[model samples]
Target chain A: MGAVTTPKQDRSRATRQRLLESAVACLAEHGWAGSTVTVVAEHAGVSRGAAQHHFPTREDLFTGAVEYVAEERSAALRALPVQGRTAVVAALVDLYTGPLFRAALQLWVAASNEAQLRPRVTELEARVGRETHRIAVELLRADETRPGVRETVQGLLDMARGLGLANVLTDDTARRRRVVAQWARLLDEALG
Target chain B: MGAVTTPKQDRSRATRQRLLESAVACLAEHGWAGSTVTVVAEHAGVSRGAAQHHFPTREDLFTGAVEYVAEERSAALRALPVQGRTAVVAALVDLYTGPLFRAALQLWVAASNEAQLRPRVTELEARVGRETHRIAVELLRADETRPGVRETVQGLLDMARGLGLANVLTDDTARRRRVVAQWARLLDEALG
Candidate 1:
């Protein structure tokens, strides 16, 4: 039988979801140093106690936030239309240029130095990386067994990420459109 | 005669140099949070007062570190043999995968969130980015007058950065070699 949710339980779940979303947004804007639990709680419009109840520590909150957004992004990727290479490439590139990526970037920078947060971020990033690669393979219909095909697809994702990095300081849209177009052409040739 | 340096002046100059190098190394290893002036001074084997003397604030120390290494990297890039596209691509990619890049990445992550540090880092990054682009053009012999050539060069640099980010988690050496090779081929065709 399908499980039924009570009103109180549904409300609690919604609050938790809001907190997670709010935390990601906070991390994206504030980095680890500035994104405190109280601040995130305030941003979420939830009490500090409620945030603490959901996430016992700062590490749990940020890591949980990244994982939540990553799952949401994966779902979004899965739901994308089966458009051709150009559209698929643009979608993948968009993944890195968005708030989720910004949040994850902050987490990565923090985890690189924070001993306590390192392993969790490492594992989360690996899982997210693998998921994105797998999706790219499926979406592009790439057979990794073929010579250079895996690298080509992987290269496309890396190039997208590089574009995202370039966009961090300035709007790289004009150059990015040209780059994306060229990558689409490259992917068409290389993937085939 | 050129002005002769006294022993005290020479020692002070060496101390300042040591502090700058140590600051970069510390930022690369420990990142922004753990990289205090006292820590950098200890790493450089200088007194805290001496470190403070060289850089009056944390902002000064880290910014000076990035600037110092950037100058060094620019000189090194300039001295590279006008190798063919493949070797030049490999060398360019190597720039992102090195310690200097690691240090710069940390600084960027910090600057993205820290209001006080943002403007300086943004200016430094822009200068470095432009310098690298100019060098890449000169090395590749790609005339920017031709359309898509600029984006091609920029794409390669972005891919190199993505590869650098990938390597942050694990050794992406084998995959990167293949990607770099493919990029060299792409560059050959696109540049022509």
Candidate 2:
């Protein structure tokens, strides 16, 4: 009985998971103005009532959604197999080019101009930013104790985000590949 | 009278300019949902009818506004004096940190999800992107004809945008300065 859940509880858990995933997807595909709770509920294959049960208001839903995306990204990062620098850089860059990044971007834009959503996203950002930085340091085997090294690692991350931003409006593939490959070499020189 | 504007035409031009500037400011301060034609009209000290006369619809206002921003930014970039690499990098990064960047960012997020606004922003982005790249090439004294040199320069611009994204919600001054400085050193190594 220690880890067992009743069927009723299991069903409830599934519904909540679906809601969170669908909310982010909806937000990514449709801006905040177009993505409504009902839209999300329909996307999740759950009733609006059930979605409301998990998150009462739009703010509650987005707050939960952002946390979920962060957890998923961190998990994805940790699961990356230890690899060569080029492969690792490519993988890290991939993190910012996907749907999760798009969803987070929407939230960031929303948070910037949204008063009610600002504090929560800001708090989440600080936490997530620190966590990602620590993970990057680990993955890069970056010894930030060395002068200029910390900023180098951060510069790499910022470049990754910049590449991601470039991709937002159009397919930044061919050019992005060049930039990514070039960054791997830079990482070698700068990290050393 | 060869190049001079008539008084009535000058007033109309001023009102149009005011509307464009106000729309961007409103978009930056308040997300797309909160920023309305009426709101921008109020901010610009123009009557709603006057704003409507200049911009028939919300899309018209945003399209015109985004163009105005791109022109302003390009003009600002052209006005920068030839400077040291660090100063050049810092100035380029500054272009992405201020209100114009904020306004453009909101439009990007909105356009990503709003199909109606997509093509126009995409067109403007490509135009503005190419122009900025050309300016950066000249300012950096970057010889892109060299292998990998083009990507190196592009990387610097993307890094600047990424730093701007990081600054959207919080003041990223301290870390940003470090990243910008580090890129200056990286440029010296990579470009050479």
Candidate 3:
């Protein structure tokens, strides 16, 4: 028999979603330091008690928010058409150049200061890395790239992540575009 | 005739240096938030009041620390022999694969959260980009490097900064070697 859907389970899921949404907004405006439980609760239109009931602690709330983002991002990434190296690189660039990436960047910066949040942030980052590597491996297979070239491509991806964060903070749009273009060129030169 | 060194000036310079050293050690041991004034003072064998006498606030301390680190790093980078594309890439990798690079990674992760700290980190980061571009322009001198190659190369350097942070945290010797090797290889291919 199929498992029954409990009312409590549904409500719990809603509360979790509320917290995650509230967290993204709060984190964007007030940054990590100002993103307290009370503030997030108010932002979410939920009571402090309800917020705590769901998240338990500020650290838990932040981790949940990041996990929520990563899951959503992972889904989007999975949906991208990874037919060839060019397509794959374009999708990865789009992912980094979008709003979701901005949110992830903000969270990472905030987590850098909070000692309790490091493990969670690091783990989420690792998971993202693994997913990206998997996509890269698949792209390599499709392109018939040598093993050494596949490894080199993964390294470029890592470099792209680091550059993307720096680019997001830049004020010059033209400059940012150029950075992404350079990434594409590097891929074409080394892997394509 | 020589210019006289006032006691106040000497004391100010000494206090500033102590605070920088303490901040470095504190950050190394405990990350960003842990580099509080109380801990810094204790680390430097000075009273809390003495540390405050030099740095009025934590932000000031952090800003001074960033500038001090930037100067030190710039000096080291300047000292490197970066005549050709290969030497340039090798010097860049050597820069990141050392203790100075580790210190930079620490400061970077810490600075990400505090918006006030962002400009300082970004400024130093931009300078690094500009310097790299200068070296690339001088070395490559190739007009065919698409309009924004310099900017992209700079962004890649920033990404290297983040990846280096991830690398240090993972504490994997193989990963570190791989990152540097890939970076070197990519640079060789892109500029060679």
Candidate 4:
């Protein structure tokens, strides 16, 4: 038999989804300090009690929200068109330089100092990082067993992240484009 | 005549130096929020009035502190022993994966959210970044006029920073060592 979708259950699920989305928005726009349950509940237009019932504490809320966002980002990365090497590099650059990165940056900074939040953030970051690496490998059709291939992948990801960090403070669009293009050329030479 | 060092002037200079060092220590351990003038002054074994006399405001304090730290780091980088490529890479890795990077990470996170701090942080970061890049270029003995040499320099710095970011939450020492070795190999291949 098919699963039943009762109105009350649907409403509960919708409320949880809203809270998660609101929490990510808060993190992206106002950073870790501003992403309180009360703020998220208000942003989601839900009652504080409802938000608490959905996510018992700030940790629970952030943990759920990061997982939700990571899944969304993973799916988006998987869906990217692999037309050519340049295209793949550009898409990865766009992905790393976007809101997902900003939201994750907030968590990274907060988790660096917050002992209670560190384990969860580290777990989520590792899972998401692995998935992204896998996607990049697949997109580039890179041979994992080849000498220097894995390091190249690591280097590319690290370069993207560094550029994203620069973008956090300055308008590094032109420089980022140039760097990506040059790296893409180097990758092409290496992998060809 | 050479500038005369009065006892009062010497004491004032020492207090300021202590405060700056304390500020960097607080940043590395506690992040930006805990690196207040009062906290730094206390950490330095100085009075709040003395801290204010030297710094005037939190912005001034942080700005001066960052500049002070950057100059110290620059001198340290210039003095690194040039044993070989692996040794240079290891030293660079050690430089990035230390307290300096942690303190800078705190400022980068704070500057991302604070408009008032953004300009100062951005300017200082750019200046420090250029100096670091110049040092890396010198260490690598890279030809700046070469087509891809500058990008290679930039790539190395960016990769170090990205690895530093990863190290903030996880013990990425093993992975960082592997990446640095692989990158050193690639750099040798390219530059040789």
Point to the candidate with the largest TM-score: 2
Off by over 4 Å in 4: A1-3, B1-3
- Tens digit of lDDT per residue, candidate 4, span A1-192? 539988998999999999989988888777786678999999999999999999999999988988888998899889998679888988887877777788788888888878888899999999998999999999998888988788788878877887788788888898777777777887777766
Q: iRMS for model 1?
A: 1.4
Candidate 2 docks with a DockQ of 0.85
Worst 10 residues of 3 chain B by lDDT: B135-144
Q: What TM-score does structure 4 among the candidates reach?
A: 0.93
Could you tell me the TM-score of candidate 2? 0.97
Candidate 3 residue pairs that clash: A162-B159, A163-B159
> What is the full ranking by TM-score, best candidate first?
2, 1, 4, 3
Candidates 1 and 2 compared by DockQ, better number: 2
Looking at model 1, how many pairs of residues clash? 0
Candidate 3 error regions (>4 Å): A1-9, A82-87, A97-115, A139-145, B1-12, B28-31, B82-87, B94-124, B135-152
Candidate 1 TM-score over all chains jointly: 0.94
Pick by TM-score: 2 or 3, better one: 2
Q: What tens-digit string does per-residue lDDT give for candidate 3 at B1-192?
A: 437888988887887798887786666566665578898888888888888888889878867776776677667666766476555654555555555555555566446556777787878777765775565455444344565556555655655555654554455456646655666667556654
Angstrom error of the Cα, residue B190, model 3: value is 2.6
In DockQ terms, which candidate is top? 2
Q: What DockQ was computed for model 4?
A: 0.65
- RMSD of every prediction: 1.9, 1.3, 3.8, 2.0
Model 3 C-alpha lDDT per residue in residues A19-54, reported as the tens digit of each score = 898887777555565679999999988999999999
Candidate 3 is scored at a TM of 0.81
Point out where model 2 deviates above 4 Å: none
